[model samples]
Structure formats: C-alpha cells, structure tokens
Target: MAHPKEVAGFKLGKLLIEGKTKQVFDLPEETGHCILINKDRITAGDGVKAHDMEGKAAISNQTNAKVFEILKAAGIPTAFVKIASPVAFISKKCDMVPIEWVTRRLATGSFLKRNPGVPEGYRFTPPKQETFFKDDANHDPQWSEEQIVSAKFTFNGLVIGQDEVDYMRNVTILVFEILEKAWGLRDCALIDMKIEFGVDADGKILLADVIDSDSWRLWPSGDKRLMVDKQVYRNLSTVTAADLDTVKRNFAWVKDQLDHLRPKVHHKVVIIMGSAADVEHCQKIGKAAKKFGLDVDMRVTSAHKATEETLHIMKQYEDTHGALVFIAVAGRSNGLGPVLSGNTSYPVINCPPPSSNLVQDIWSSLSLPSGLGCATVIYPDSAAVMAAQIIGVQDYIVWARIRFNQLEMAASLRVADKKVRNLSIE
Candidate 1:
C-alpha cells in the first residue's frame, strides 16, 4: 500500500506514527492539525493476529466520525476535526498517551479470563474501569491508579499525575456510559470498550484516538449471538477467504446501525408565563436550557384570566409528538404551574420570579393542590437544569451535556481549593 503525500488538498508532511490499523501524518499547511488515515487492516492479541479486509478502512472511518460527532455535541472535548475522505479524517495533533483505558458493563472476554469465577454475563453496577500500559511486547499489562500516578510521565509539557489520572478515568467512564445509553436507545448493548487520550500543543487533555466497531464489543438486543464487532474477526482461528467476507459484512452492518443512533424525537422545554411582563425571567431560563441542547418555546397566557388559552397552549405542545417539559414562570398568585400540571401528563416546574411578596409567591408554588406533581425552583437556571434532567431521561445527548457540566463544576472547585491553599504559603 502506498501512502499519499496529499489529502483533501492538504499536503501530508511526514508520517508521525503508524499503528496496527492506522497512520498519522502531519499536515504541512495546518500547524495544529493532522490527518489520520485508516488502513484496511485489523489486528488482535497485541498484533499476534492480523488480516486485511477490503474496504474496512472506509467502514471504520464512518463509525469513528459518527461517534466523535456525538461526543463533541455533548460537550466532551475530542481530537476529531472532520472527515477528510472515505478512509481518512482530520484531527488535532496531539502527543498520544500510552495508556488504554477500558470500561466494562458486562463480565466477558478478558475480564472472564482474568477472573476465572466470574460468569460470562455478570453485570457491573457502575461499569468497571481499568487502565493498561500500552506495551505490545509485554501484552499491555493492567496498571493500578497508583501505578499510573507513580510513573509521572509527561506529555506536551503536562505531567501525568494524580489529577490527570482522575480526569482521564472519569472521562473514560463518562464516554462509555454516554455511548452505552445511545446504543441502548437502538436496542443494542455495549458490553465493554477501550479508549485513549492525548494532550494537544496547548497542553489540554482531550478524548483522542478512534472509536469504531474495532473499539467495542456490541451485541444487538443484548444477545451475544447477534454480536457485530471486531470480536467476530478476532475469534476466527483459521481465517479463510469466506470468513473475511463475513467479517466485512458485520462491520458494514455496525456502521449502518450507527446511522440511526441519533434521537428522532426533538425534546423541548416550554416556558409558559401568566403575563408578558415575565419575559425577562423566561429568557433567562431559555438561555440556560439552550446550553444543554433543549429547545425552548415561551408563551404568555394566564390560568386565572385566560384559562382556556393556557390549556390550549398546553394541548398544542402535547400534540406535537415530542417529549416536552413545561416551566411556569408566574410571579403573584402562581397558578400557571398547577393548571399545566393538572391538564397534561408532561412534567411541570414552577419558577416564581422575585416580587414584593416573595414569601407568599414561593409558598403558593410549594403548596400545590392534590394530584398536581409540579416542582418549584427559586433560580431560573435551576429550573432549566430540572427541565433538562426530566427530558434527559430518554435523550442521551442532553444527558451527556448535563453530566459533563457536573464534571466541570467539580474541576473548578478543585482548582479553587488549590489556589486558596497556595495563597497561605505566599
């Protein structure tokens, strides 16, 4: 196979690295970017076995690009830029980390071999995680958190310490869970998967490497017999021409399934207020909702004065055939939440604006009538988060954004604490 010097009009400068099934080349025109070209090759057992399947590169690139698209949309930082061609993609140039972070939802494959007594389908409550040092000659032995921290490796001027390890581990588990929920929506089970991370020139750690059928053990409808992943190729002891053809078909099918993983229903948040005067408060909620990928629609109608109009608005949204949560932002004598909650099956939340009689306004929202299960939040942003959570039950992209936000919050606190402790020494 010959490596092309130019791809998508970008001149490939030099081969940066070559892996079992891909090659990384520096882009001469793009200082911070590179091109990753997938090969038609697949390997397992640390390259003890290898095979070349026609068109596997294209299939792998398609799956990887789609997976990265979901991750980037959900607020996870990654190295993927865009698909350059059928078998190649553009990416941020990063110093690759020599660790393979694996997350498992079911006890199978290597886990079963490592732990003899564990049954084949044993489930993990929180999905187990493990790290392996990438040493093909040594079979990539598993490393403990302590081992990773003690190694103190450096990548792009950043040290791999306790803090870095923690970040990578949390993100690894998050990546797995996000994709697991996505595949679950398609009635597929993500048994387990491995991922790698890298540090770019800016020293920011991003979710790097490729994720495709080669990266996971996927089973359709939770049945192992219907598994469609690289495992099928790995399990073949004596590969004949006919066996390779079957493996190619499975890869193609996996790529096809990813095309339908995105949600068909557009979940939304509807903010209904008693008066147009509350538009500012509703706008605040709308802004926060959009941050988490929730579509927001604001309307003004009074449950006390324009009762029929308010119910009509609720019915119109319910008939749209999409999941929606209603946020009532009425201040005085708050009855909008109760009316909307009682009329529709969708979740309702009351966010009362601050007024002269703030105490009474809050009490009115808290003290709801019987069978009216509407929740109340004082801050507008909190109401948006609650609505996102309610809709995120079935929306993987929204759920991932919310989860990633939580991680960012925790990281901010850690940074703040470190600064405070340093201040005392100064």
Candidate 2:
C-alpha cells in the first residue's frame, strides 16, 4: 500500500485526478473508497464562463450530502459515503459510465431545441428520459436507447447490454422522482436533471458522481423567473463578483431549506368506530394514514350504545403524550364525533360509514350541536387527508408528504391532459 498523504487535514492515499470543479483522491485505509473534493468554483457554457465564487464549494458539498443522504434513506443504491469534510466526501470507487441520464418533467431548454413544436411548460406524464454520450469535444450529442444498448462498453468487469441500459433507465427515473419529491416539499419544481451511474468492483451499478448545483434546473415556487439553480449562474451575460455572491446565496438558501424538511414529531392518529360494522371504514382511514407516516390506533366503541366504553377509549388515549387527533367513524344518527369532541379537546373529525342511508348519515355528522366542534368529511381518502393535514401543521415530514402527494396528483392530470390535447388525427 502507498504511504498515506494529507490533503486539507485528512490523510488520503493518492491524488488521482482533478476535474473542472472537483478533485478525486484514493483512500489508503479504506479499500474501494475514494474522497471527492468539491472546488469553490462555478462554471457553465462548456467551461467558457467560470467564476471562483467564495463559499461555493462548502455549500455544494453540503447540498450533495443532504440529497444523497435522503436518497440512501429511500432505499436507492448510491456510491455515497458521509461527508469527509466541508468540501469533500468519501464514496465507493467505481468505473464511470460514459453517458448522462437526463429526465425532464417539463418541455424546455434543449428539450425544446430537439423537439421544436412543443411549447414551454409542456409536461411529461412519467417524464421524458434521454441519454447523452459523455463526449464534451463532440458536444455530448444525444443518443437513443437503441444506440446505448448496441454499444458494447465494459466497466469494472460489467458489460453494458440491453438489460443494463434498461435498468439504468428505470433507476435514473426513480432518482429524478426521489429528488423531485424532496424539492416539492420546499415548493420547488425540479424541471429536469441529469445523473450518471458507475459500476462498482462487485459488478453492481450505483448512482455515482456529485449531484450539486450544476446537476439540474430548479424553479422555486414553480416559476422560471424565480429560478435558483446553476442555470442562474450560467445565464449571466457579464459576470461580476457580486453576481457570483448572489448565486452562492441562492444555493445557500436551498441547503438551508433542505435541513428543515426532516420532521421529528411523535404525532398519533386515533380512529374510533361506533360498531364492528364500521371497522372497515376505520381501517380505510388507517391504511391511508399509514402511507403518510401517521401512527393510527383503532378502537371499537359505540358512542350511542356503549357510551361508557367510548369514553374509556378516549381516556386511555388521552393519557399518552404527543399531539393526538381523533377520527370518529359512524353512520346514521352519528353521535360518535360529538361525544369524542365534547369529552376531549383534541381535534375531532367525523367520517361516516357508507350505507343506503348515506345522506342521512352525512347530515347527522354535519349538523352537530352548536358547541361540539367536530369536523365532518365525506370520503375515506378525505378523512385520511384531513387527519394528515392537521398533523402536518406541526410535522414537516407530514406536510412534505402532503405536498408531494399533491404534486403527483397534479402531474398525473397534466399527463392525461397532454395526451388528450396533443393527440393528432391519423
């Protein structure tokens, strides 16, 4: 083994090479590990326009660490190790894939250039996927999936085949979605992005390379005019030191917002039903709540028949510490909601079980006596959503889940609308 060398106070094995904005170092003690040092520089227009912005490298490293950590937590395979320092991090060493996987959720930029007829904001339902060969001298020309599959490229003892290309395609789309959801929590649109994969020593493909400010176009609040990504720095006509500082500040804000999306609340949702018959209704809410990280407890006690038992259920839960919201599941002459609402000060919501008497059931829950304070909702999804929204008030994770759900629903609609609106008569 080579004698360990020191770089930026850390003992690294050997200096491999340096890119335009980062340097790679081999790790002496850790086998198959390498350190990546992000530089305090920003570049665009094929490196013709560049700036050594103060505080950019540390901030980029922070952003990459935050994003990669979230991806790893979501079960996505990556080559990321923890941040080694403010400007560097350790990662599994892998042979690089010679292509970039780009996913676009909207029609803009080069997407418009390639497909001239499409308008801006033209949405891609599942998002449009493209591959670009990593040949900077040849301008990194876009390649089709067929060309990618046909090319026999080997990296780290792994051969690129149709199956390999397909797997990368699927994984790349998944990466885009994971980051898209993360950004959606901050009310930002991840319009499009590019990612590169690498084959590790064990012949497994991992999402490798540094995804920092330069990797994507982000439209905060879904407005291009409010864009706060590397594109902002790229589009500057005449660069000034202040312009670099301004762009650095935008990057700082993104990293700061990412810090707050992680919620640490022990909020619980209690689902109480009037009878065994309403068990299905309560479970519907429970299952849906589970998807959004809500802890649900189901209790069967008739507010009309076994009033004492219902009160006991409430008492049992009230003693537990944390934010609690009660959902009353009952139908026809509904008394469960009001009983729970009057007994406990926790937020009470009424979600009536379905039956032929649905109208009467809705009316019963909706027309609660003047001071009862129980809210009424019609569908199981709505009931679950209402509970989530109430919980989201204090839990950033819950709020993020809600926002991501909303973005998905809206994105689905855009896909369906595009299909109907763009169909050509053949």
Candidate 3:
C-alpha cells in the first residue's frame, strides 16, 4: 500500500514498514525520526481473525503516549519521541530487532497452551522471561537465550551478542516489573507483557515498538474476570458490533486509569550530622539521595550537645509538606538517629562516619534503645537506598529510579559472570 504524502504537517517520505495494527513511515525532512500511525484494526491468531474497532486508533495512541512518558521519566531508553496526532506518534527510526521479549508474573493464555498440564494463574516469582523470533507466519516461535546469542543478528551495525542479549533480558524484566508495580498502585495487576527492541543509527539498543492495550495482560483488582486488555478482544468466539464496543470501552478504561498512575507527590531527605567532622559522610548520603530526585538538605547539629537546637531543626522538616526521611550521621555514642526517630513522625536512618575503630563506631549507631525505631546502615549508598524506598512508597517517580538502578546492577552482575565464565580453562 502507498503511504500518505503528509500526515499532521510532517511529510512522509516512504512506507518503512507495516504491521497488523500500525504503520511506520519515514519523515522526509527528519533524518532520524519516523511517524508511527495506529490503525483502528485489531487482530488475533496471527491476523487470521480481525476486526475494525471504531475509535481504537486514537485510544491506542493516547495510551502509548502516556505509557512511554512514564517509562522515559523512569530513565528507560525508548524509541518513542512524542505524540504527533490523535492516531500517530513520532519515533526514532531504527533497525528493529526481530525478537519479542515476554515477561510473565502469572501463568495463563499462550503460556498454559504451550506448556500443557501447567495450571492457569500459577504465579512466577522474579517473573519468567521468554524470547520469540518475530515471524508472524511461523507464529513467533519461542527462542532460547543461547539461540539468540548464537544467531548474532546485527541491527544498525550493532551485533546481538551474549552481552547484549543479557542486557535486553535484564531490561525486559525491569520494564515489566516497573510497570507492574505502577499498575499495582492503581489496584490493577500486570500479569504479563511483551516488548520489542531496536538498534538506533548510533548503534544504541532501545525499547521500540508500540506498547498499548495490545501489549500486556492487565487484570484489574487481581481478578482475571475483570481484565481490561486486548485479551478481552481475543477471547471473543464470534465477533459482533456490541462486542467490539465492549472491547473499546475496556481499552478506554485503561487509558483513563493511567491518567492517575503518575504520582505528583513531593519527597525530601534531611541529612543531619552530629558534628562538623561528619559533614563529608553526610554529604555522601545527600549526593546519593539526590539521584532519585529526593530533595536533600544537609545540616550540622549535635543531638547530645545542643538538644534544643537539634529538636528545632527537626520541627522545621516536620512542618514541611510531603514525605520526608531523616538520615542521622554521628559517631561515638551516636544519639542523633534515636533522638530524631523518637521526636519526629518521619523515618530516620543511621549512617555513622567511618573511623579507626569501625566496629565500635557501628555499635553506637546499631545498638539503640527500645521504642526508638531508627534503622542503621553502614554505607552511605545503602542509607540513600533505604531513604528512597521509604519515599518511593508515595512517589512513583522515585520508585522508578530505584527500579532503574536495580536493573543496572543486575546487568553489571551478568557481565561479571560472563567474564568469569570466559576465563575458565576450556
């Protein structure tokens, strides 16, 4: 099919590719971007069964835009640029990876069909991942990680080696888990999701393709009967006008719920040092805390020497709005954490400055009196992580940053493991 010459004022150069539900067109003037236009058509069983649901294009574009916005804010790299129109969006042009990465939190649908005898709704801890080669005629057959690395398929001059495969696998799980937690906040369970990747002109691999109603299985209120995803459309035995409308309504509900998913809550972390000597240690905690967008305020006050001044500092933060976390940095009979924890209605973390007698220093912070609920961490980074976890309970943005860091750590471990494996004598 010939592509449109112009769409939403952006001139379409050529028809790049077409899928069952979307079409990609190269931008004539934009060298590195393309326009992806969603179609009203929906399909199942590898396009053997299909329907043209009204208003689906606009609904899908809206959902995809919102989902990608959240993901990009979470620091996940994606090809999505911005929404171009009601039915289309702008994206980075890339040589697409011919693989679909699927992560599952619960066993159902094709998973149960492929692995017979496995009961439906069997939960998978850490989530199970499967890779499928992108071949529609072949029903997107499952491919193992070993097979993926062995294939060594190159896209945009970048080879898909074991390292790359490991990175993608880790990222696929992160994307699913992050979105899963986001949905969980809205009382919806993200059962499973399939995502694709692509290599850009600069040879950087990124999450690509559209992620809307058709990409995942979402069960509202943890009940499969109340699913509000493309599965509802696929489950229909016989298509009818009213059935399509019901499916459309389900899709619209998902889009509506997403509007409330991105949190607007403010979070702050106050790092209080017992003496000027602990300023360096407290600053380290503040540095790490700022990475997750938590407002960090460093102060100098001795809980033992100036009790009134210390209590005055606590009163200020207690009066501030939003979620707050306090980090107490002190050594030699540390009392800041206990004092702040006892006085204020906020979480307090104890991170003592390193000294010659490390064990003795830790004891001061660790061995706290009963009823004082202050937690202790040895490293500054650990203290920051604990603070982020506390703040993330109310802030989705911070929650995403925490998850993103976890993904990076997991990827690094995989690379280290691969290095050790290669060093072994053959």
lDDT by residue (1-426, candidate 1, tens digit) is 677889878799999998999999999789899999999998889889998888999999999999999899899999999999999999999998899999999999989999999999999989999999999999999999999999988988989887788889989999999999889878999999999999999989999989998899999999999888889888898999898899899889988888888877667799998888889999999999999999899999999999999999999999885789999988878889999989999999999887889887788899988999999998989998999898888788898999999988887787687678778553
Point out where model 2 deviates above 4 Å.
Answer: 1-4, 263-426
Name the top lDDT candidate.
1
Q: Model 2 compared with the native: what TM-score?
A: 0.66
Clashes of each: 0, 0, 0
Candidate 3 Cα RMSD (Å)? 3.2
Q: Arrange candidates by lDDT, descending.
A: 1, 3, 2
* Estimated TM-score for each candidate: 0.96, 0.66, 0.87
Cand. 3 Cα-lDDT: 0.90
Q: lDDT at 222 for candidate 3?
A: 92
Q: List the residue pairs that clash in candidate 2.
A: none
In candidate 3, what residue range of length 10 has the lowest lDDT sum?
Answer: 260-269
Q: List all candidate RMSDs to the true structure.
A: 1.5, 9.2, 3.2
lDDT of every predicted structure (CA atoms) = 0.91, 0.84, 0.90
- Candidate 1 Cα lDDT to native: 0.91
For model 2, how does the per-residue alpha-carbon lDDT over 14-109 read when each residue is reduced to its tens digit?
Answer: 777677788888887889988988888888866878878888889999999998887665556789988888888889998888999999999988
